[model samples]
Target: MRQFFVFARKEFYHIFRDRRTLLILFGMPIVQVIIFGFAITNEIKNADIAVLDQSKDHYSARLIQKLTAGSYFRIDRNLQTPKTIEAAFREGRIKMAVVIPPRFGQDFFHLRKAQVQLLADAGDPNTATTLVNYARAIIGNYQQELNGPAALPLTINTTVRMQYNPALKSVFLFVPGVMTLILLLVSAMMTSITIAREKELGTMEILLVSPLPPHLIVMGKVVPYIVLSFINALVILAMGVWIFGMPVKGSVVLLLAECVLFVLTSLGLGILISTVTDKQQTAMMASMMGLLMPTVLLSGFIFPVESMPKPLQWLSNIMPAKWFIIILKDIMLKGSGLREVWPQTLLLTGMTIFFIVLSIRKFKIRLS
Candidate 1:
């Protein structure tokens, strides 16, 4: 026990002495969370739009005012002819164009229907779709106000309740993904590199030949990293709750326990990586290329896994981050308990066991 503490303390000293490693371990998570939460977002704000109001009536003017009143859009230019609509989009000056047909008010009052054209730049289909939807919603609201509650012949009042995230803030979606990514990078990549560095310096052989058991040596090396990774997880959770208003709807103790499990999984994978590679650079590159890309692209972090093709969906099933992200969303957003997340927890545990066994076997082979 004394030997283990001495070895663990040495590992901690080594980590603190290295400034670059300390920065990457502590600084990277904060920076990534801020960037994903604020900079990369699905919510559109103050998008430029052009208006072509041909009717020049009270209804058309009011409609335009209603569209621009919200934070979704701002009128960048007013078009006189239909010819200029394409020019506005081509020049990158506008994301959408609103064209109110001739005699819009007359048609609305007498015929009980009016046609308004929304011309959107289809280059960015998602953003364009959102812009058009916003415009339609505003126009629908105005129509509702004009018609009154009993004006329509048939009415289907559909009430929509956005369960978990009412505002649909992108931060809520990204915080868990960011947490998963940072933990993987720090725990797996850093641990692998640290062990590989020892091998490169010929210090691993010295440690292996010492009085300590091989497993004890490995644990001593890894214990500091586990502590560091847990600290990082706490830091990210705090930032998400305080800075971005993300809520932990489940038991906070359960959340931290799950985080520790994930850290152990990553550490086992790191041990596996270190057993295979002899150089720090090789381990780092392998960790990034093998772990980072899959975690980002296949983990359903930025895209929906269900929306992917069947083969890709099957491929995504193997990504640990996919399960972790699901578990996090369920816990943080849905307020789920252990029973709800047992399947994912079991899979993560199995993966951790597999990695640990593989790494131990590989280490033994190397020793032989």
Candidate 2:
């Protein structure tokens, strides 16, 4: 019994001494609670919207004011022309667009039925539906307000036009996210674990002593993952297109190139993980904590980033999967070209370069 107590005391000291273990036990829960508490939300807030109030009348202005008055919507752009609606959606500027046709107040007062078109970017079906529903509820409430003062109740007919995805298919939205997740986990996690395994088995030391240059050593370790992850991406894309009828509207060549770039970025991230950890378990844990959680929560996979608080939104900018998912959606759903997606492409490229350079530096330190 005394021996058992001493062993337990020694184990507790050992756990306290290892910062990584202490972090897994304490730091992860706090971070997860904070992230999940704030991030895992279905209710949309502060979603940017555009209003093209051609009516420009008293009622139309009042309705516009009503829409933006609450926390649900903010007017980012008051579009001058109807032609720019598609451009705005393509650029990912706004979630929904409100078009009140000419003579909206007159129609409401005289005809009792005024038409308001709600144009929603249904690329994310859930958000699109939620936005439209919120808009309709507001419109309904406004109708009631007018009816309260009138002898007869007025009607506001809302015409919902779901852009990008008229059918509001759920599969369209999940494909890009799943592809990003698979590539990230397979490329980054596998590369880190494989390299860490080499270190654990003492083969990495042998390679470090060999004639192979340090950069090549890292490249050679990650090259197989790039190929495998690319293949994995292609398979997921094929399943999305053929099995689920997901549309690929943009240039296939450009999409393939972007996939390759993302895979390389993920591989670089994995190599960075391997450089810091000698054990496979540590490498896996680091990859999951550092990469996976951020990718899911902050990358706009399941939750909308715009709906999150300001700080989480800012932190989301650092996620590679976020940029890649945007690229995927831009190409696949929006049919966006290099001109539209160049910024995200450049961001991913920069991240890849940064990861590789940092990994090489860390590897050199290990070599010493």
Candidate 3:
């Protein structure tokens, strides 16, 4: 036990003594978090739109009011004719144009059917679709108010409040994922490289032959990295909180516990990779291609997991990062407690245990 403490102390020395490693472990996470938090987002705001209200009546005016009220669309121009609307769209002053026919209010009052045309620039299909939905919803609300309930016996008004991210900001999701990626890269990828480097330098044999037990030797090599990565995690969390105003609504202790679990899981993977690959290059490549690629692409970091095909989605279930990201979002954004996120926490814990067991078994086999 005393020997273990001494080795752990040595690990801290190595981590602090190397400036580059220290910075990568600490600086990179904060930078990546800030960059991803601010730069990458899917929510659209203040997209320019044009209105062509030939009626200039109460209905057209109210419709314009609703459009402007929602922060998604902005009135860039008020065109008089169809020619002007077309010209505005052609000139790129507006990506969408709404044309309301003459006597729109009168038609609604008498016939309960007023025609409103939504002309959207389909050059960008996604933006066009969102604009159409926004316009339709706003107009639909007005139509309901205009026409007194003639109606169906039952109405289901399912108002969905996207709780954690009411604005549907992608950054809210990306911040945690990017943090997980950087943690895995630093802790798992770098540790694998370091361990394999020792083997290539023939120093691994020297360490093995030392009075230190094999497990202790491995621990000494990894402990420094663990401390370094922990510091990086803290730096990233600080940047996320300060720079992005990302709230950590859960207990800080719970957040740190989850992060440490994720780091240990990654480190176990690194140890496992080092045991499998003889060369430093092979270890690095395996870490990059085998682990990093899947974690980033398949972990629902950039894409919705539900939208993925059945097989890929099932594969994602085994990814440590996927569970980590879910736990992170629940704790940081939704203020979820241990009770709420226990399932994800348990999943991550199980992965960590599985990875550690596999690595230990592989290491024992290699020793034999």
TM-score of each predicted structure versus truth: 0.96, 0.60, 0.80
Give all candidates' CA lDDT scores: 0.89, 0.82, 0.82
In order of TM-score, best first, we have: 1, 3, 2
How many angstroms is residue 189 displaced in model 3 relative to the true structure, after the best TM-score fit?
2.1
In order, how many clashes per candidate? 0, 0, 0
Best by lDDT: 1
Screening candidate 1 with a backbone cut-off below 3 angstroms (N, C-alpha, C), the clashing residue pairs are none
lDDT of 3 by residue, 1-368 (tens): 78777877866776678897667667766667767787877677798998888999877898889888978899898887788876787898788998889998899878867899999999999889988998898888877776667676787777787877776767677788888998988788877876677777776665666687666666666777776677778888888778777789889999999999898889888988887777889998998889878998899898889999999999999999999999999999988899999999898889878876777666532322
Cα lDDT tens digits for candidate 1, 21-83: 999999988898888778868899999999999999998999999998989999999999999
Span of ten consecutive residues with least summed lDDT in model 2: 29-38
lDDT of 2 by residue, 1-368 (tens): 45334433544464457686445433443344334434545668899999998999889999999998898999999999999999999989899999999999999889989999999999999899999999999998898898785643676766899988886666677778877876787678777875688778877776666666677677767665565567667766776687667799999999999999999999899999998898999999998888878899999998999999999999999999999999999999999999999999999999999999999888852543
lDDT, candidate 1, equals: 0.89
TM-score of 1: 0.96
